[model samples]
Target: MALCEAEKTFVLHGVEENFRIDGREREDYRPMELETNIVSHAFGSARLRLANTDVLVAVKIEVDVPYPERPREGKLEFFVDCSANATPDFEGRGGEDLAVEISNSLAGAYRSPEVFDLTKLCILKGRKCWKIFVDILLLECGGNLYDAVSIAVKAALWDTRIPLVKSVTVDGNNIDMEVSEELHDCQKLDVTGAPIMVTVCKIGEQCIVDPSAAEELCSVGALVISVSRNKFSTILQTGSGSLHPQTLLECLQTGHKVAQRLHDALIETLVDIKPSENSVGFLR
Candidate 1:
């Protein structure tokens, strides 16, 4: 996201005036579009487009044994794939570093048990549990990737449905479980407390949320804060600039405020989403 001196100056002046180049306030996010159940094969799926930053999240459930230490808890894994279609620089393994960074941030954000309860996915203690694989695909790079990815992940989890376990039988050392035959007999994941990431970019002396590609280039440093309920789950600082303690606190406060609004808007949008007969993947 490189910009010339004049472009940077324009953005700086706009920020100083509390009006961005895109006609948004300093804390305003770009327009977003979300759709769920786009992948019929996966247990759940959702696609989100925050301006030009596009992300797709799919949840696949597999039965597996619980961990040795946490026998009653299930597992959640995150994988990020940056497609070459988004940018030529991501071809082959070029995007590995960025991919790992995003995936690790997601893992950390969901690490707290209070944010997402893995116990809900446990089938039989120590014997059987559902391992959820959250696969995220990046189709664009308009900026604010972390926020967009988190939103998509939450939407996918919200759309996910776990099959009902009807009965479980133990035959000596082996165990067999039967799932409900009815298609509608499923349980939805509780994502009310799911964390939402908000990127606070420092352009000049002002902090901004949801920076665009140009604004990202103008930023000296940025903080990615994950808000789960009323607390922060994780925080990562990026770029090559240092911030004072007071500035950091101010940035965190801004992130938390905007995250709450973002979370509320996401839930409202998801609730209003209706099943469409046609699939609107990337063709649109």
Candidate 2:
């Protein structure tokens, strides 16, 4: 995101007045579009568009042994792929750094047992468990990539349906399990405690929740806060600028408030989503 001095000044002034270039409030998010089950082949899938930034999340499940240390817990992995279609800069391996950063951030946010329960994924004590693979694809870069990715991830997980184990028989060391043949006899994951990330960008002593491309370029410091069930899951400082202790506290407070609102809004949106007969991947 490149902006001239005049453009930067204009954005700064707008933020100061609490009216962004798009006429949104400082703590308001841009228009967002979310759809679930976009990828029929995957176990669960969702696509979210926050203004121009677009992200696709797909959840895949497999049977695997649990980790030795965490015997009773299942495995959850996050993989981020930044496609070149988003930008030429991500053509080859250019987006590796950003991808890794986003994936790591997501891993940290979902690491807590309170936020997400991995034990529910365990079929047996330690012999068999469901491994969840969350694959995120970045299709565009408008701004606030982290927030959009997190929202899409949560929606995908909510849409995921785990197959039910009808019967499990253990013959000595060999164990066999039978999954239900009925398609509708599946269990939906509980995503009530999933985290919602909010990016708070500080521009001239004021903090903004969701910033645009031009607004991001003008910000000196930023904070990314992930809130789960009214508590903070992860908090990180982004950008090169430094902030005072008082300012940091203020930013955290703002993030907490904004995250809760975002979470509530997301839940309401999810409830309003109806199963559509037609799938709209990107055409719409």
Highest lDDT model number: 1
lDDT of each: 0.90, 0.90
State the weakest 10-residue window (summed lDDT) of model 1.
Answer: 275-284
- Write model 1 residue lDDT over 1-284, tens digit each, in one string: 46789999999999989999999988888878788898989999999988889999999999999998999899999999999988777988889999999999999999889999999988888899999999999999888999999999999999999999999998887999999989789999999999999999988889999998889889988999999999999999988888888889989999999999989888877776666632223212
lDDT score at residue 33, model 2, on the 0-100 scale: 81
Candidate 2: give the clashing pairs: none
For candidate 2, give the lDDT of residue 221: 96
Put down candidate 2 lDDT per residue, 210-229, tens digits, no spaces: 88778888989999999999
Query: How many pairs in model 1 have backbone atoms within 3 A of each other, for residues 3 or more apart or on separate chains, i.e. clashes?
Result: 0
Off by over 4 Å in 1: 276-284
Query: Cα deviation in Å at residue 209, candidate 2?
Result: 1.0
